[model samples]
Target: MRKLKIGYIPMFRGTARGDREILERISKELTDLSRTMDFDLKIGSEIVFGYDTAVKAVAEMNSFDPDFTFLGSYGATIGSAMIPMDKLKGLIGLWAVPEWELTGRLPLNAFCGSMINAGMLAKFHTEKHIPFKWFYGYTDDPLFIDRFKVTFQALKAIVALQESRIGLIGPVVDGFDYMLVRESSIYDLYGATVDRHHSVEEVIKRAKDQSEAAVKDELAAILAEGSKTCMVDDEAMNRFARLSLALSDLARDNGLNAISMSCWTNIEFNYGNAPCSAISRLNNKGIIAGCEADIDGAIGMIISRAMADADAATMCDLVSVDRADDSLNIWHCGPAAGCLANKCGVKWDHHFDMGHYEGDEWHGYGVVADLTFKPGDITLSRISTEAKELTAFGATMFDKESYQGCSGWIKDYRMGGKPMTLAELLSVIYNNRVDHHMSFAYGNFESSLIEFANWKGISVAKNTGYVDHMELGTLGK
Candidate 1:
């Protein structure tokens, strides 16, 4: 889990009894509430009052080195006494308390000050091309709390990406041109980079060196976890488990946060089974993994996991469209996260292509876990590079029952607003040149994704034909 450091600066009109009283009350309330809430935001112990106090506070805030700085106001204050907004780095937020919270004549002029400070900060951030968010409401309003939650989570996701170190194995599979990524571009856009392990040979060699006892224990653990539904023979399942342990050892030894493997002919030709089950196990353990050496896909999963607070997420292809019901089939060979699998719906099985071979028939070739994704709201997201520039897009939709095989269904896919016809939807995907694989989590992360994209210097792709009704008011503006 990621912890967010927040530098909270509280401002008020000079020496006035009403302004001071309200600031004390709200500050105390916010401070007390902070201890009770489960969120990861850690705030400063004291508030700054003016230029002198703000100078000292800014130095202290620098020591803390917060990811976000909150400039809060209870009322309008003397000119030039406000905190030095220019000193802050990263995302800057202006929170204005509602003047209406007080019954009598305006003591705080909070709404007016908020508007003034917001405009000024907006101009400053715009000129600096810095990311920022704001909220205007009483301290107790649900709306205020919700906005804070979304913004903080979004910031957390961005910070996670900035700090990620990924282990990439092999290159893009032959002919999957859409999955290509440049390490320089990834570093520039998301602050993530690749540590390429050129061959799967090292992984295979390490797996073969495992002791018989260790391999037996791993296979036993797999079986105990309901591997019987997989239908794969013990010999093949054991080899797959050994490979899974090898990958986990490599990941831990190298201090990798995520991995992208090349599972086409290289690993299968040498090891006799695909790495899907291994990939699934890694994802279930909160380590992001991607197929065909897709660094971008792994990064997308990392972002989703961070925003969802380590919730399980998976990568699947936007395979086919269900035209009749305006739904799309999300399928992958067998790499779905075990944590997200429907109860009793996971089968340890073989790749679909292997099923067509002589006498093997779905129970041969490679070991995989077939799963029908649990029914719930799903966010489909991708990060793609074009001419060395990275861009992102996300859609919030719901998953339905499995349609066929272990495939999952995402119904009513809409972006911006309004449902899109299958043709229109395909057009947007083609126009944007997004990869076939996307990351899916069991909750709506559209807001966080949008904000994160904006912070990274790209506007999330939107439906120009629709109403543009995504609840991202003034985002990326």
Candidate 2:
């Protein structure tokens, strides 16, 4: 997880009595909390008590370039809080402390100040909007701490997306037109860069150029891990190691935080090997990798990783729905990280779908990791084409056998705080026209994902069952 930088703006009215001491105490509490939190807090050198002081304080805070700013409403005038609220680039937090005492002449009308500031900012930001969150209660309050932590987690995920550089190794697969996304739209929406100059041939050439010793060492390490190797022989494993090393080098050479590859007919037909193992290896190493050149899927994996504090995320297809058992099966051509494998462990085997191809040589594409996902709470998410929207849901993986390849059975799915039946979930997918691929991590991140979408202004689809309005007029009543 990335550590966030937070700027603190302490506000006070110059004429108000006893505000200086209260502001100082608030600063001390925040500074102490920062030590325990996963963020760095930068407090202004002096409190803002007037317009000129507010301007100077804004300059000082802006120099820190915080990912989020906290405005301590310590009996401050609306004008003072407005300076940082308008000047800061990211989300601003309005923190109002409880009154110090109920006795004579209210020492600090902090809550009233915060309400006035919120009203003023809301009116001023009608045209050019700035996101802000409200907080009440003292720093030691449990509710305050919980909200603060959740916001921090959401901001960290947002920052990760803004800083990501994704490399697309090839075009989307032949029939998967739905995976296509405009690179410019991705940048405009998520602040992530998409580099498409790298080609499939480059990866192949790099794989071939790897030194024999390095390939042998990688193969040895993989074999030493005790995964049962099925039809795949030592040569096939060696080929997978070379490709894995090549992909790793490609990401490093291009400075990519994530990669999406076609990983299909071209690589399988020409290179005589599939990249499922390579994708798994890269994901395990914290370099997010997606199969079939799904750029949005790769971005979703990156978001999952960030939300889950860098846990490896897997991209899988919703293969089947079992109504009797109330479960859904998620599977892919063996690209899941080793850490997600069940106690049965990973199995190196042939790609299940390659046998349908015509040639005898196609049978040699035997290097996929076959395993079941370990039982845990899982969060599934996806970004739509053109980066226009996002969807996320929470489910629990059942501790039961799954079909061949990297797969899992998930039950008890919920979205938008509502428990969804299997039919309802299917309806949501159909109505929304969600992509076939969804990325998942080993934790419940529904709230974090929603928060991230809110922060970025990305639409969140919380579909429940089917929508009557979605029917065509000619086909419906």
Q: What TM-score do all the candidates reach, one by one?
A: 0.87, 0.93
- The candidate maximizing lDDT is 2
For candidate 2, write residues 1-477 as lDDT tens digits.
457998888776756666777777877888898888757889888677666877788788888888888887868575545744687656788888887788888878888888777876777666667778888877778657767877877887778878999999988999999788988888887889999999999999999999999998888767664364556777778789999999999999899999999897778876888889888888878899999999999988988888787558989999988878989999999898888888988787888776555565445476887889999889998878464678788899988778878999999989987788776777767656778999999887788788888877887876546544654321221
Question: What would the per-residue lDDT of candidate 1 be over residues 236-343, giving only the tens digit for each residue?
Answer: 787888888888888898888888999875688778887888888777777788888888788888888888775577788887776677677888887767777776
Report how far residue 362 has shifted in candidate 2, in Å: 11
Clashing pairs in 1: 230-348, 355-362
- CA displacement after TM-score superposition, residue 191 of candidate 1 (Å): 3.1
Regions more than 4 Å wrong, model 2: 14-18, 80-84, 102-104, 226-228, 356-364, 385-387, 465-477
**What TM-score would candidate 1 get against the native?**
0.87
Cα displacement (angstroms), candidate 1, residue 96, comes to 0.4
